[model samples]
Target: MRSLLYSSLLALCGALWARAFAQAAATQKRSVPPGFVTTNGRNFELDGKPFAFVGANAYWLPLLNTERDVDYTMQQIQASGAKVVRTWAFNAINETELPSATETGLTYYQVWNSSDWVVNDGPQGLQRLDYVVSSAEKHGLKLIVTFGNNWAAYGGIELYINWIYGAENATHDIFFTDPAIIASYQRYIKTIVERYKESSAVFAWELVNEARCTGDILSAGPNCVPGSNTLKTWYSQQSDFVRSLDANHMITAGGEGQFFSAHPAEYWFDGSLVSDYNFNGQAGEDFAGDLELPNLDFAGYHMYPQTWYPELDFPGSNFSVEEWGLGWISDHASAAAKANKPLIIEEFGVTGLQNKTDIYPSWVQHALDTGHARVMPWQFGVLGLTEDGGNRAIKYSDQIFRGASPNDGKTHSTLTRHKYGISSQRLRVFKANALDSH
Candidate 1:
């Protein structure tokens, strides 16, 4: 009798699993909110509304360069006030769809990887975008799509001969300078933007990753295209393209450090601004009156302090969590003023270095204190997921809220909801009271 009962239970369990799998398949097809923009809501807004984002970028996409891990990592991110998640086009969109493999619309290794530029539309690329867009919606997170990278930053002889210009080998080449490159890139961007236009999960269409100056292009160029000039031209073209197709959504360029400095070369896109921040550059440069970039609709900044500067590294390693917090806070204040726009602490977090420490609270407090930039701490489970694990993953129990581990089979999540207790209301109230006195 006992044996028979166990067998019956096993059969029921198997049936349930099969049914659940089918449901998931159905859900994928069922229309999901592509992504969202907080034009006027509390977390985020569209035109004149309150639009804030507490998010992070999924840097390592394993299947495509650690992207397989992103689905898992996002579970932890959702728990950490991350309403939006960013991904590169190569890692997230269809790349090889272009006419020639030499075309470059969006690539993974714009900074480091060296893959032949291929026409997008590969099954892998399509699947990747659908999976991410669908998955982000399922998990209540928004997607910020970046079209390009600053690969031009690491320009050298080899880069020039092989990568950009494609000398000896016709295969490896950057399609940007090639006149033929325009249509294909336009197609790729359109495909993505069109597909996800109705997606409420999509926050905004970011034209490019970083608007690196022409001089800063990794490989030297002929006319020496100015970063601002090149970006402005590119942004204008793409922005027009996106607007023509999808007029409902917002558009922005991934402008980080450029907005903080006083360099005239940094100026571009006269209409609306989507400012980006990196805590490493000119730490305390004021954003409002200091930079004169007050025409911003929204301010976005990246916060990966410890990774860039080892001195500012988090606790259990070199720098104390408190010290790191101060560094981030100072940067946040500067950018917030210059923006005079809603704040998006776009990219901020501790890296997954072997010597990992939990300085999340340091990050939380800074955001809490200012109430200026909506805080999106560095990351969720990118590093290791626990103290017992290797790299720089946050503790699941310490930071995350309710969420399942996408990588439960391989890694345990150390993230918890407790870490995010720095109340937004409390932070605002505190700042207000403190300010009145002054």
Candidate 2:
């Protein structure tokens, strides 16, 4: 999801899988009222009140090039009225790693030499993350910090696999099976939870951005199977492991919300007469099953229509992309309701400001209407400098938006003009947070 649309719409999205705060050994702070956000079945409760919010995906917050960037980014998101922000808590650097353009700099939390890895909780490493948490607290916002990713974007699951087995030989799904790797992941999780366990600003801890039976550069090996059971067992173990560390905060499998149903038409929103692997247990995600994991507090799903299923976006399709997206949202909402767990539409967006303008309204409304969950668009972009140092985003997504067919490889200059303005930021941002239609 990071290549085309992301590059065009200003790339920064998050992933969350089923891992985190393990052991069930977690203890509440000595005498404090819960510094953690608690769940009320399908809804969230904060300070004894119902808590539902429009969050933002500022994945670059912890990995920003400088502290100034961190402070400024948080200010803008807080200004946007986004109650929560999602960022990567796991940043690892290796000679073979591939990260986003914004993920560069010395802001990593871990490092791998040729032999083993070192967790950096020093000033240059996780202290940046601590600042991110502290800044959100200062801004009166909460945070969802994801520990790892399935994609090889930052230091993902593959990164750990790379350290265990060579890149060419590494299998993605081994992360769930390897004892050494599991212990390593849990060690880092322990460090993070212990650090933020008492901070109310931490909304949740995501095990990985998006977990699956596959990896980016290297796919899964023989041991890894593309069914719910294999993934379910690993997720079960990880969630329980997380419960052992800190029992106060919430946890979720930051996932793409793929289902395990072999029958396509069985799901009301599937719109399929035949079984598609994405829906029929082959793609290693089972939304409802993930929710049932004991220590998991909620469920998550990412929506990307043009990327995952381009046929529907093509001509002569049964419906428009927005319509398909609406179905996807409804499907997940029903799943979350059935599981009686709060859901988060953590990552979703369409390119072309015009498309977003015409599309997001119904999708966002449908999401809010269907359940007690949060709708966080893929990102919150800044008026960044173009390669030539000019200041026009041509067309950006997030709250401030514009246009282009990233699908068709259209240039920024090729897009039809949409008057760019500063007012669009605050106005559209509030639109995202509030239920107001733009």
Candidate 3:
């Protein structure tokens, strides 16, 4: 009898311990903070505190770099007084369908097909992005997670277009019109939003990076521009879809500050000269109308005056670089003000190759003075030159890193490196212009 009683007690204790352990695990899964970043009138609020940020682009943070590199880079970013970072959350691979030369043959392109997205437990897949979210939280930084790309760099819209309609018939515009492609994209978005819904580290979701239609594979050229109505409809649908999944985060169109006019024939070249790439001209994006979406949380634009307006004889050339940049800011600010929404210059940079360092501080100061919520330069990384050359390259050791061949591109000059990285001069400008405009 005594032996039996002891055995029963042991069994009961084990059962209780197991139950407690399971409950603990469940609670841990739901432990993410409930509070999230939000917008009020025209300002952003985090945990009930007004938030303004000076940030940088680390587009490859979650996809290309290592844990150590992410850690080091985040530390440096936080140290530089940058409160937020923007990085890609989506990278497609092998999702595109290709047609073979033979009538009965079909081939699939696996690279850049992000549709096979899985949040598995490993260094690859969404595990790397999971690390980024957790690390950004640990180091006190907010993230702007862009969902798709307009360009072909990362199997962007082109991959989806090709996947739905074979590569032979693929066009960038189909990404907006095709029902099957839209469904596939929504599925991918659902997976991502469901996975990250509980985390507060994400500040906003960008529908696409510079969402524009430059034509299909065969007819590819600057002359091809998708209709503004098509682009806006797609933006509305996607923003609504994201809102359906995650209600806490904000949404942005990710346009390049292209103003739209109905009377393109009459008012085309009056304010700014039309160019294949110029947003004010034939570029398909309608910045103001896009921001007017009921679901879009804020207005955002990218400024590259040096590249966008390189010709001296351009209509706006009468203004200095600083004036041109400020004018761009003013135009966007006016639109945002009219809409009663906050504005962010999500991407802007002056290439050192252009010898335009003087334009940097001026732009920063003007942006702050104009009440822009955030100004994130093109990028921040471990590879660029620092003030004393103390920072070293953070080795990207993952297979994807090796496969992508990030280093295969042309090397930037030391001066360009200084401009891109958190050099002392740039840091000083960023820090000094960073104002708490609550």
Top lDDT model: 2
Ranking 1 against 3 by lDDT, winner: 3
Off by over 4 Å in 2: 1-35, 95-104, 167-169, 226-228, 265-274, 384-438
The clash tally of candidate 1 reads: 73
Worst 10 residues of 3 by lDDT: 23-32
Decoy 2 TM-score against native: 0.78
Over the stretch 312-387, how does candidate 1's per-residue lDDT look in tens digits? 3435554464464566566655554434334555655443421122344334445544554354433433333332
TM-score result, candidate 3: 0.72
Over 1-438, each residue of candidate 2 has an lDDT whose tens digit, in order, gives 111122212111111011111101222222225555777667676775556676777776665545665676666566555678898888777644424322333466777877467887777688878888888888888999888888876677777777776567667777888888888888888888888888899998888887888877777667665453767777788788887887778888887888886564332234655456567766677777777887788888898887866655667756578887888898898887777777888888776665665676677666755753477877665433122232212112311122111222121111212223314354445344434331
lDDT of model 1 at position 203: 69
Relative to the unseen true structure, what is the C-alpha lDDT of residue 287 in candidate 2, on a scale of 0 to 100?
A: 75
Sort the candidates on lDDT, descending order.
2, 3, 1
- The local distance difference test score of each candidate is 0.43, 0.65, 0.61
Off by over 4 Å in 1: 1-35, 40-43, 46-53, 60-81, 91-122, 152-184, 214-217, 220-233, 259-297, 307-338, 351-359, 382-438
For candidate 3, write residues 25-142 as lDDT tens digits.
1111111145577766666666655566666677767643356656766776676566778888776555232222112111111333343433333445577788889999999888
